[model samples]
Target chain A: MTTTVCGRCKSSGAVTDHQGRQDGAVVWTILRCPTCNFSWRDSEPARAIDPAARSVDFAVDADDLQRYPKILQQ
Target chain B: MNDLPNRARSISSLRDFLELLEDSGQAITWSDPVMPEPGVRNIAVAASRDANGAPAIVFDNITGYPGKRLAVGVHGSWDNIALLLGRPKGTTIRELFFEIAGRWGDQEAQISFVPEAQAPVHECRLEQDINLYDVLPVYRINEYDGGFYIGKASVASRDPLDPDNFGKQNVGIYRLQIQGPDSFTLMTIPSHDMGRQIMAAEREGVPLKIAVMLGNHPGLAVFAATPIGYEESEYSYASAMMGAPIRLTKSGNGIDILADSEIVIEAELQLGERELEGPFGEFPGSYSGVRKAPIFKVTAVSHRRDPIFENIYIGRGWTEHDTLIGLHTSAPIYAQLRQSFPEVTAVNALYQHGLTGIISVKNRMAGFAKTVALRALSTPHGVMYLKNLIMVDADVDPFDLNQVMWALSTRTRADDIIVLPNMPAVPIDPSAVIPGKGHRLIIDATSYLPPDPVGEAHLVTPPTGDEIDALSKRIREMQLGALS
Candidate 1:
C-alpha cells in the first residue's frame, strides 16, 4: 500500500534495547519502521548467536552489588 | 518476494531511529545549548551506577550544525529497557532473561526506495562528497577516542555461501570507524554472528550485501547488538515485547530493503580483505585495541524523509552496550538457570569492575548451591563474561549490589568456595581468565545448612500491603532511629 510514513513513525528504531516485557518476559527484538512508525517485538534466536557453551567471563561491579542491599542475602 | 520494494534499512541510521523514539514516548527533546560532545553523555554517566538508569536526551541546537539533531541516553533506565522489550515499566533483569532464553527470532527487515520518491533525509544532502566532519556535529565523547568512531551499529547482510541462511538474516550491531564520507572500516568483533556471516561469505568468495542501520528506537539497537542464538530473529523478539509486528519499508537499490528503519547505507564486503579500524572506547570501559579489519564500499545510501543519524556512546561503567549486555544478554542467562533450578532467583551480569559475579539462589542441597554456580558458567551469557561467580540465597536479588556483597561478607568461606581458573573470555573482561581464556572460581556464598536447617527463604513473606507500608513509614517518619 502506497502511504506516506509519518515523520513520527520514521523517527528511529521503534523501542529501546534490552527492555523488560510480559509479566515475566524479556525484550526479544525491538523494531520500528519510521514510516507508519511501525514498531514491534520478536523473540531473540537462541541457536544462532552464542551457539555453544562458549566460555566467557562476567565482571562483577562491587558497587552494582552494593546498591540494593536489602534484597541481597547474607 | 512480497513485491513493492522493501528497501533494506541498515539497522544503523541515527535519523530514522529518532522517529521511533518520538512515537514510543521513550524520548523527549531538550532545547538546551549543545554541550561539548563528550560532555553530552554525562546524563548517562550520571546514572550508570545502576543498569537501565539513564534518561534519553535530544540536542536541538548544536554549536555548528544550526538545525541538525543529536540523541543520547536511548536505553538508560530499566523501565526504558523494559520499554525496549515492549513490556510495562519496572521489568527487572531476571524477567527479561526468561524471555531471552525462549528464542523466537525475526526474518529480515529491509528497506526499498524509488529515485522519484523525495525522502526527508534529502532535505540537505551534501551535493558534493562532504567531509563527515562538515555535515554533522560529530562528538569527542571521550579524550581517548583516537578519532570519531561511530561506535554503535546494527548491521544486516545475507550469507553469500548458503542460500538457506538468506531469508532469516539477523541485524547485528557493532562499531564503525568513520574515516571519510565514501569509506569506513568495519569492526565486527571476532566470532560475532555478523562477523561470522561476513567471514562465511568471504571464505566462499561471494559478496556480502550490507545495510548499516544508523539510528532508531534505542531499544532495537540493544536487540541488534545482543548475542542471542541465531535461530530466531531479534526483531521478532522485539515484536513479542511490543505486542505487535515491527513495521518496515523499502530503500536499498537491491531487493533486500528494510522495514521500519531510520536509514540504510548499502555496501558490499568481500571476504578475506582486512583494514585497521579502531581505538574508540569499547564496552569493556577500555580502549579497544586496533588491528586490520574489513573495509566495505558504500554502493548507495537511502533513508526516510528527515533521517536523524544514530550514535551510541562507549565509556566507563555504562554505555548502551553495557546496558544491552546486562539487561538483554545477561538477564536471560538467569532465566535459563531458573528453568533447571527454580530457586535460582536473580542474576546480574556486572561490568568488569569487580569483574566477577554475584548470583542469588536458594540452596536446596548442601552441594546444590555449587551446582548452580557451575551451571551458571555454562549459560550463553554467563560463559562469555564471568570469572568468579558468587552464588547467594533467594533472599538476595542478584540485581541489588549491596545484598550480594553482604552475602559475600557474611556467608562466604574462602575454602568452601571452588575456583576453576582459566576459561575463554571476551577481550574486555578485566577478570577474564587466561586474559581471554582462563578458569573462574565459584563461591558458594548461600547460607549453607547452618546448625540444623530453616525452611527455604522463598517461603518467607512476613507481611503484605498496608502493614508493610505502615512499617516503612514508621521507620522513616517516626523517631525510630534507636529501634533501627
Candidate 2:
C-alpha cells in the first residue's frame, strides 16, 4: 500500500476523510493530516497536494504545531 | 408581516432579490463553462473594481460541477445595495447611509417563526453519508487560501449560558474553512460575540451548537455583517432593514435560521479542541497567518433543491466585504453618536471597515469637536476598529471626500492632531505592529473656535440657489442632447 503524506505538514499519518463522487464513481479523496489537521483534496493542483510544490509560507512543521497560538485558553 | 410597508416585503428570499436585480439590469448570467478556481474569483475581483455599478455574476456552467450554480458579487456595488434597499440605482451613498440610519430605531421589528415543513430550506436533508464536496460547490476563494471557505454564510449561535434568551442569540458572518466531509474550522476574534460565546462554552466544558445559514435574505446579510449591541437580535434588525417581518425556522439543533436559506449546516464546536487554520486572504488585503482555531463537527445538513452556493471574494479593498459592511457600519455609529450629540451631522466610515472615520459636527464650544471625536471612539464599533478619525464642521459633508479633504487642508492645524497609543485594534490590520494593539489618531479638522482666531477670519462660501439647480438641469439635458 502506498502511504499518503500531508502536503502542508508532510506528515505520514495522513488519512482519507471522505470521497467526492460525480456519477456513481468516486472522483477524488480528501486526505487529512492528524498531526497538524491540514487537509487537501487529492485531485487539487500539485501546489496544494504536493509538499514539494506547495508554497513554503503556508507549510507547517508537525512538531512545531504546538507553537501556534490557540485562539482561546481552556 | 402585516405591518411592513409594501416595499419592505418585496424581497423575501435571495432568489426574489436576484429577480429584482435582473429586472433592474443589475445582474448577469454567465453561460460558458469556466474553471472554478481562477474563473469565479477573477470575475468577482473584476466586478468589485467597478465599486459603483457592478452587476452580480452568476456562473451557470462551472466545469466538473454539473447542475451546481455559484453567485458572486451579489452585493458588490452601491447600485445593488440601493436595489436591495428598494431604492433607485442612482441613490447617492449619503442618501443610502441615512436611509439605513433612519431605520435604526426599529427595535420592535417583528420576526415570524414557521414550521419545518413550511420552511423552504428544509426541502432536502443529507443527514447520513454526507460529503461537503458532493453537496456544496466548494472551491478555493483565493489561490493561496489554506482551504475552501464558506465566506458569506450568516452563522447563528447562542450564548451557551443563556441559550433560550432570543436577544442573547447572535447571528453574524464569520469565515469557515472546510476541513473534511463533515468538519470545518471557524475564525473569530475575542471581541466578536461568537468569540465570547466560545469562551463561555470552553469555560463550561460544553460544545457550542451553531447553525450556518447560507444564501440568506439580503437584509439578513447586511445586518449579519453589522456591528450591533451584544444582546441585540440580528433577525429583528434584519426585519427593520427589510421594513417587513423576517421569516425563520428552527434547525435540527433548535437554532433559528432564515426560512428561505438555500443551505443550512448544523454543527457543534467541540470542547477543548483546536486545529490549524488560515493563511487565507483576509479583508486587510493580506493573507492572515496560520493560527489554531476552534474545530466544528457537522451534525446535519439541509438545503433547498439545487442549492445556489453563495461565496465572497475577501482580499484587498473595494471587494464585496467593503460594500456589504461599509454603510451598515457607518449608520450604527452615526445613530449612536447622534444620541449623545445631536449637533453631529453625518459620519463616513466606509474605508477599510471603519479603521479610519470622518465625522461632521457643529462645534458648540472650544473643544467640542475633540469631545465628539472622543465620544465616537467609545461607540460599539469604534472601540476596536476606529483607529483614525477626522473631525469636520457641520457645513462640510463627511460622505464627500472632496469636502473632507478641503476641511483637512484648510481647517486642520499641526497642534490639533491627537494620538492615543496602545489601543485595542482589529487583529487582521496589516499596519498593526503588535497584532491586536495599535495607536489611535484624531485630527480635529473643524475650524477653530473663540480662543483660536487663526484662519477663522475670511473663508470663501459656496454659491447655492434654485436658479443654479435649474441651470444645472438644463445644462445636463443640453449635454445629453449634444452627445445624442
Worst 10 residues of 1 chain B by lDDT: B1-10
Evaluated at residue B308, the lDDT of candidate 1 is 57
- i-RMSD values for every candidate model: 21.9, 2.5
Off by more than 4 A, model 2:
A1-7, A12-31, A41-54, B1-8, B455-457, B464-484
Pairs in clash, predicted candidate 2: B285-B316
Query: What value does the lDDT take at residue B436 in candidate 2?
Result: 91
Chain A TM-score values, per prediction:
0.23, 0.87
Real A-B contacts recovered, model 2: 0.42
Per-candidate TM-scores read 0.69, 0.93
Clash count per candidate: 151, 1
Top model by TM-score, which number?
2
lDDT score, candidate 1, position B483: 65
